[model samples]
Target: MKATKITAIDFFDDLSSPYARKRFFVGFIVFGGLCIVAMYLDHQFVPNGAIKAVLDSVLANLLSSILVILGFYILYTFFIGPNDGLKEVVPTRARDISEAMKQLPEKTRSYLFWGRSGSYFRSSPLIVLDGYARRSKIMTNVDVLMPDPFDERLINSYRDIKDSLGEESDGNPLLANVLATTICCAVLNANNRYLSVRVFYSAFLPAFRVDLSDNGSILTQDDKSKGALFFKPSSEFHELLRTSILNEMAVSREINLEEATFKKKKLDSGSCTPEILARFGVAEAARSALAPKIATLIEERRHRYT
Candidate 1:
């Protein structure tokens, strides 16, 4: 009935780890036994005369060597100490957004993703719709935000950027796919009773994509080739990203998709009804152009499962 609380320990803890706790206990015991043996040997081997002097000199040299090593280590630690636990949490770099999503935990209390056209999220290996549906069933609060596809100027500008980046040149097909994906999201929401899904349309597009889960946050550029930045839940960067997304959500227009439906019959027929598009506010003229693209997306998904 209540949302699950996810902490640092929960995110870091591999739910199905193969490593055993007993092995660590056994290793600790072995280390203690070795230390006892070494101490015993040192007690028994107390030398006299020239042997004593030689042993003393050897001990002094060994102690000096250890001190020198410790000093160097201390210096190294002094320089790197500020980043102590931080480096372990943050990866070197994510090659792209998908790679960055892989860094986040699979289970979360809440998940928010705001991007252009839901393109990456729709096709992401980490955030597949089937998995998302399952998460929704478990009451994960999911929010999806993107630029309004119906906005001609916005789509044109988006297409231009994609063209510059050598991506797909046709924004119309992309917007159609985006609309199809929106219908799928509506299907998810209608099936689930909890805080499952909400879609928001913004007048303007963001330069970068933001994905926030219970575990952490990942900020990525629109261009897939560019690197992404990730921050753990408690970090300042993470909070900043979270706050920015929340603020953006406050101003964006959240659309109602209650009328959108995807029956098995529709998939078999390879058709997205105009009524669904009407609910999404797709203009009459654009519906014809989008219909085939929507059908293509549905067929591809069907093939994926069948």
Candidate 2:
């Protein structure tokens, strides 16, 4: 089916519920109040003149130090946090992806699966395509889709690809070639008609690449590059796959699938007044409103494609 346009609201509505919004707002208010109190204390406690100046300097330094420490802590929590623990967020998605891969055929399975490295900001999606050029045994391409800019770890990872192949030292030829190939593939594979992946970064910045063509042909020129063969699945396909995987996983754990489905329904309803008081949470009313429209779009695409 043709992919439907996903608005910012649709994505946020699906991902977050009213309870999540309440929690976020409460946290915001508390933090904001604390910051206001801190500002008041700074003004009230300082005597004025040189004494106030010294005190301001000290307070500034203290705040800066705290901010720096907090930044590092959040970074660590996102990246190198424990994977096998309940506290881990990204690992849960990784585990789900791994489980989903097992349900597909061996050859096709690799095409749909990839593991995330410990570096969160530097992490990218990995997929093994059917055909892509390869100097060594690895025929996969990495697509860096992180919302943030590329960091040192990612650059180093690209560099390390050369060392990975022990004897095939073409003096960093693979690094340069891979970078160019990835950029070319990413540009050709972009979803938007007007914007190619090359636009992801400025001319001065580094860009990521993925294997787009069937069987890696880095240098071939054509109207439709072979790289365009890396299929982009429709949203319906993704939604159905996600739902099936979640249901299967729940069943394997001996959990009552009905309760999970009910929870999702409640969330979709916008948590105003759940059927059961105890289950009240934020709802995604917008999703339900959009469902019929999405269904129609899917049906039209299916008819056209078939």
Task: TM-score each candidate.
Answer: 0.62, 0.19
- Candidate 1: count the clashes: 0
TM-score of 1: 0.62
How does each model score on lDDT?
0.60, 0.30
The predictions' CA RMSDs to the true structure, in order, are 11.8, 25.5
Q: Counting only residues 3 or more apart in sequence or on different chains, how many pairs clash (N, Cα, C under 3 Å) in candidate 2? A: 13
Tens digits of lDDT, candidate 2, 1-306: 212232222322322333444554566556555655666687998677996787677666665665665566446547764222221111112112222222222232122211111021111212122122122233343322211113345445434543553423333222222222222233223322222222122111122222222211111111111221111233333434334333433332211112332232321113222222222211344334333432232223221001
Model 2 misplacement above 4 A: 1-58, 61-68, 71-109, 112-133, 137-306
Model 1 lDDT per residue over 1-306, tens place: 112222222322321111222343355456555645554565578655786566556655655655565465446546643332433234322333444575453767577887776655544522343465475566667778888887888888888877887766764634775676576666656655544677888887778777788778877776544555667786767777788777888898887867335433333224466666776777887767667668667556521101
Query: Cα RMSD for candidate 2?
Result: 25.5
